[model samples]
Target chain A: MAKVPVQFTLNGSEKAEFIESGTTLLHALRDKIGDTSPKGGCHQGTCGACSVIIDGELRLSCLTLAETCSGADIKTTAGLAEGGVLHPLQRAFLDAFATQCGFCTPGMIMAAKVLLDRTPNPSREDVVEALSGNICRCTGYEPIVQAVLTAARANSQNAA
Target chain B: MELRRDYFADVRKDGLHEIGQPRPRLDSPGHVTGKTAYFADRNFPGMLHLKMVRSPHHHARIRSIDTSEAEKHPGVVRVLTAKDVPHNVYTILILIQIGPEDETVLADGKVRWKGEAVVAVLAETERAAQEAAAKVKVDYEVLPAVFDMEEALKPGAPLVNEYHGQNYYLYDSGECRKVRFGDVEAGFAKADHILEQSYQSSPIEHAPTETTGCVVAPEGNDRFTCYTNTQAMFFTLDNTSIILQMPGNKLHFVGGTVGGGFGGKVDVIVEPIAILGAKLTGRPVSFIYSREEEMQISSPRAAEKVVIKDGVMKDGRIVARKVTGYTDAGAYSRHSPYGAQKGAGHYPGPYTVPNVWIDTYCVYTNRTPSSAMRGFGVTIGDFALEVQMDKLARLIGMDPLEFRFINAYRDGDMKAHRQPTEGAALIECMQEASRAANWPVAEKYMAMSSYRKGA
Candidate 1:
């Protein structure tokens, strides 16, 4: 089998690697690049467990080909904390007890960050729409919605 | 299965930290940070991928299996047929009744189900193993199949297991569990009005975000480690040990971060397949069910048909209640015997029927095996009884809430079967729910509006 060389910035670190032509971005980040924090859950992109920020846009890594991710800047769940301090959304998810089971939290948090970065102050419906793709079985989406609203309050206070 | 109440009395006083409070799961951080490794994430050097070649026919006599073409494929490691499997009848999910073991991990001389595994393929790549699986050919003599429970119960129907006697799994005419208390016939005779109706509950999928997946490998000499996603991890470990014919200590079970169970993940599904694949390849193997496989092969919630006969006195008190329910325990009796017992335990609406009789029939079907879901069997029973209660109340010219409260089993009251209602809060929950939902306004709107009984 012929190996294809791919280069990308993962969690702000540059790396070049060789992966199979059919390798998914999820397999490359997890198996090849030794970044196991993004998770592997339904490979079909239905369960958003493999979500990562690619070129500053939230995307399902399982659905994206390794070749497509070449020369792209990607951010994973491991980059959510700044120098050991938890992100506002992460803290809110923890404090509000919205992180039950937690399989979808990384994707949900990344999805929320995209919404929060753009909106800064999102309504309930906006928050729902932002995290709609991410499916959480335990929390029933109530606490997750509340967590986003709480994080929005904290973010606005920090901005002021 | 033996029916017994497993409720912990005075459990609240045991510890303040045990229940009611939001105790954060210890594994939350790992899962949230994507640090929790699942079965599908596990990988080893020189590991092989395993895939099964399933039978398309629901019931068939296997004439021949030609794996020569598949074995010659590039990257293919090995192809295991029924001749390789030691156990002719592989049963991980055994029926609770202790008779009629009705399943196979890999089909032997006969294939009873459509998705029954016949041949297993191990290859250098998952894609290769998958591609090679499609090449394995099996000649089968197709037989008559039965898919409906009622049809399966009828005499002269196609037998799922011909040795199990007359298409029925267990004797006693489909009614696995029955309960009788008081003079139900005499009570019905004395009643002013009698109501008979049948209600059907639909089958629902668990739809767990994480599909079933497992990775099996040799831990060391005479030992193996299997990582799987399951609801009852310890139970699955015990079942896997029995199926593999290995000692408990020789098999190690590592649980993956559970996506969701809702009671559906309690069965043995993918772990055994992975273990079988590992044994064949002598290399670490992982088998993850695709979404389609998860839906078609994996167990779903059992559907039920309930028939209720209610008797009410002129004074708005329930005189007697008779209920007969048929549970569609698809393919195999996974949890049906116990589910039948629970479904017929009590009619479980907040009413005091002086006389009662309940019987549950768990019939077999050709669909995916039915297993536990949320609320076990009580959820389906409660809906049927509650709706019938509402209809009965309307017949007696009384408000449904008032009728329910009049006969509702209180904490100290004896139930229809003369059993004390331990820790009952039926009235309180109903009142609170009514207050919370603004029931008075809703009721007034329904009464004032042109919403007749049929409309």
Candidate 2:
């Protein structure tokens, strides 16, 4: 099979690469582009560990082919922080001690980022509903839920 | 998550710093940023991907295996069988003198359970390895398999494990792990009423977010560096070294941050094979279980069947308790033997029953070999014991909490294992739980303490 060429804006930077026809965006990012943020949890979109924000929508990278993601803008958990400054969600997750084992943190943060970007002042139930796709087996969902609420409050206070 | 005002008033007489303080995990930033170096995160130059050719039949004799088609695949490097393993026979518990080396790194002659690896194919890519693995054919003579614990133990049942020479692994005394304290029959003769009930639980998976995996890099002078997510690092190093027949120092294990082991990753499953693949190919090799494989093949919590018989007095005192149970260890003993022993040790619960007897059988079945999970042996036993306690309380028309308060173990009590109980806090814990739940206790029960009685 011939490698197909792909170009996309990744983490606010333009990048170009050649990928196989059936290569997933996750493989293209980790294997080809050398970005290891998005992890492969269940390669079957059931586990949201491969979540990436593409064109202002949260999509599972494992389900999205690299060819389909061509010319799209992608954002991963690695790109959330700017100039060494932590994103409010990242800061709040740390402050609330929401992460354990940390394998689910990247995808969880990515999913939470999309939620906060769209609904800044999401209620506890809203956070729970938004993060239903992401699974963190260690924390039992309480600390992560609390962290998202804390981040939402912090973001609202900053805006005020 | 607010702490109750009197939550630790009785337990926190001694000041503590790290015990109840809010401390952020050291790895949270790395986790959030996706910069943490898990075993799968690292990629090496000229690294080969390994995929196992597993058995489709639960119980079968391998008539023959044909690896020609797999070897002829374009990117396939090498295919290894049990013959390639230097020391093929192993059980994780062998380090503690608890096994007869029942399992092989790869299936040897026969596969006792479904999904047992028979061949390992190394290739340039994971897809190529998986494709090649599917091509390796095996002719199997399927045999009748027994899956139930009790059925496997009956006379003329299909043998599940040949290493043990029986369906059950015997303790040093040549029987099931036994816990005999006092004359239970005599205690029962003096009782007013008796209750008997059976409890059963299916096997449970740990289902950690990150599945079991390992990456082995061969280095100079026969040294191999392993990056894994195992909870027990030294156990992996020691067991993998034993399996590889190499010096313990030759394998340098670099791991501590498990994605969520919960006792699952303690089994030395992938490291030895990954190391062997690296050694045979003279290149780095990575072997990771897919989520399906992890769920299907990885060792799960042993399913348990417990029968609890209690002799109780009208005053809510348990005169005698006998717990006879079976822990389905599946086809091999990984940790189930020890887990069964632990279950027997936790018998009669945390109470002061005058007489107690426990017999826990580590029974084998033609299922995925069960091993450790969170609280492996004791958790299931506690499930049955506590439920029995609740039922016993209800039968005698006593409040469950008050019944427990009356029978809770105190310090200086003797356990069923002939060991004196020390620092027992069941009374205090029940009191705290009742207080938290606002379950009103009588003034007499409230004064109950775990401190040494009659001191």
Candidate 3:
């Protein structure tokens, strides 16, 4: 099989990799570029573990083709931290004990990030709706929902 | 979340530390940053992928398996069958000297259930391994299969496991775990009402986000290092050593980081074969179950059925209780035998019944093997027992909470299993619960205490 060459901007840096024709964006990032923050809980899109931001829109990397994202800009959980400083959402998650087992944390954080970007003052129902795609077997999602709500409250207060 | 200070005020020390404060977890930073090292995160150079070829039929006799086409496929490294395994038979409870380990690592002669592994295909990539596994041809003779426990226990039913001559797991010298206390028949004859009801529960899957998986890397010194997401680390290592017929020192297990396991990852399932692939080829081997494979092949909590026949009075006093229970120990006996004994022990629902009789059977059937989950044995048992109590309370036209307080066991009361109760607090718990819910009862019922129990 011929390996197809693809180039894209990842985490504000130019990245290039030669992958197979049907390789998923998940394998392209994790196996080739060596960024493994996005987990692969399920190869299908049902589990939002491999969720990433593509041009400011949340996308499921497991279901997206690498060749189709040749010139796209992508961001993952590895990019959430800047200069050793954690994001407000990450801080809220830590303080609220939202990340248990952590298999679903990355996707959950990305989902929450998108929801906050669109709706700065989201209600509890909005937070729940944003995180409906991700599944966390532990913690029963109470801590996670509270963490998102806490982060939203902090962000809105700063804006005000 | 209000705590009653006066309830245990005498024993409570002043200026207590670390009792009711929120403690931050140390791994929160790694978890929030998505930098925690799970088993699948680590990768080695030139690692081989392992994929399984499973049985399509629930019950079938395997005539032959021809791996010629699979071996010749592109990027295929090796194809392993039951013949490749050194010592195939293993049972998870054998660490505590539980007898007769009968389950095979790979299906040898016959497949008793659907999705039982028949052949393992190793290749350069996961896709190639999956494609190559499909090329391997297997000849099977389909047989009649039984799904339910009661149907399997019937006379002349098709056998699910040949290890036990009968359908039910043998307990000491009886067909079930037996519990006998005071005479239940005599207590029932003197009762004003009899309540007999049957309750059943369906199987529950853990369904953790990360599927069960492992990666084994062979070191230069002839030792293999396994990175797994198993809940029980030492149990997995010891069982892997026994199944591979190797010394424990030759295997270095790296774990204690599980994604999510409500007792689902306790069984040693994906380690042995992945280790064997590494040992044979001198390369790291990764065997991860897909979501579909995890759902269909992995063990779930056993479905149980319990029948509770209680002898009660119009005054909400449960005099006698007899229970007959059956747990569906599907195909192989992984942990259901011990679970049945636990089910038998949790009888009559914490009430102070004078006479109690309990018997629980672990029966085999042709389905996915049932093993551990969160509160496997006792969760469903409690569900049935509490429901029965509510029915009895309704029958006697009394408040369920008041009825429970009337039958609540005291600290000095004797339990049906011949054990004296100690530190009994059912009454206190109910009283606090009523206050929390803002559901008021009569002042007379509110004055009841667990120290002294009566109507």
Give each model a TM-score: 0.90, 0.97, 0.97
> Candidate 2 at B283: error in angstroms?
1.5
Q: Rank by DockQ, descending?
A: 3, 2, 1
Error of 2 at B3 (Å): 6.0
Model 2 earns a TM-score of 0.97
lDDT of 3 by residue, A1-160 (tens): 9999999999899998889999999988988888888999889999899999998899999999999998998988889999989988999999998988998999899999999999998999999999999988785599999999999998888889
Model 3 TM-score relative to the real fold: 0.97
Q: How well does model 1 score by local distance difference test?
A: 0.76
Looking at model 3, residue B112 earns an lDDT score of 89
Candidate 2: tens digits of C-alpha lDDT, residues B1-455 = 34444533655566555666788788888988888888888788899999999999899999999999999998999999999999999988778887789988899889999999899999999999999999999999999999999999999999988888899998895669888888999989998889999999999988888889998899888899999999889878888888989999889888887778888888888999999999999999999899999899999999999999999998989999999989999998999999999988888889988799889999999999999898888999999999999999999999999988878888788888878888787876777788789998887877777873542
CAPRI level of candidate 3: high
Between candidates 1 and 2, name the one with more favorable lDDT: 2
Residue-level lDDT of model 1, residues B1-455, one tens digit each, is 22112223223334434445566667766655666676666777778888889889888999998999999899998887766654435444452334455666677778877887788888988889999999999999998888876788888888776535554435353546667778899989999999999998777788776777777887668677888878878778766766666677877888856767688778776676677668767788877777777777777788888999988987778888899887777666667656766787756456667788887787776666678888867888988988998899899888787677667775555676568767665655555556667664234322221112221
Question: What shift in Å separates residue B301 of candidate 3 from its native position after superposition?
Answer: 0.8
Which stretch of 10 consecutive residues in model 1 chain B shows the poorest summed lDDT? B446-455
Off by over 4 Å in 2: B1-13, B452-455
Candidates 1 and 3, the one with greater TM-score: 3
True-vs-predicted CA distance for residue A46, candidate 3, Å: 0.6
The runs of at least 3 residues in candidate 1 whose Cα sits more than 4 Å from the true structure, single-residue gaps closed, are: B1-23, B88-97, B166-174, B348-350, B411-418, B440-455
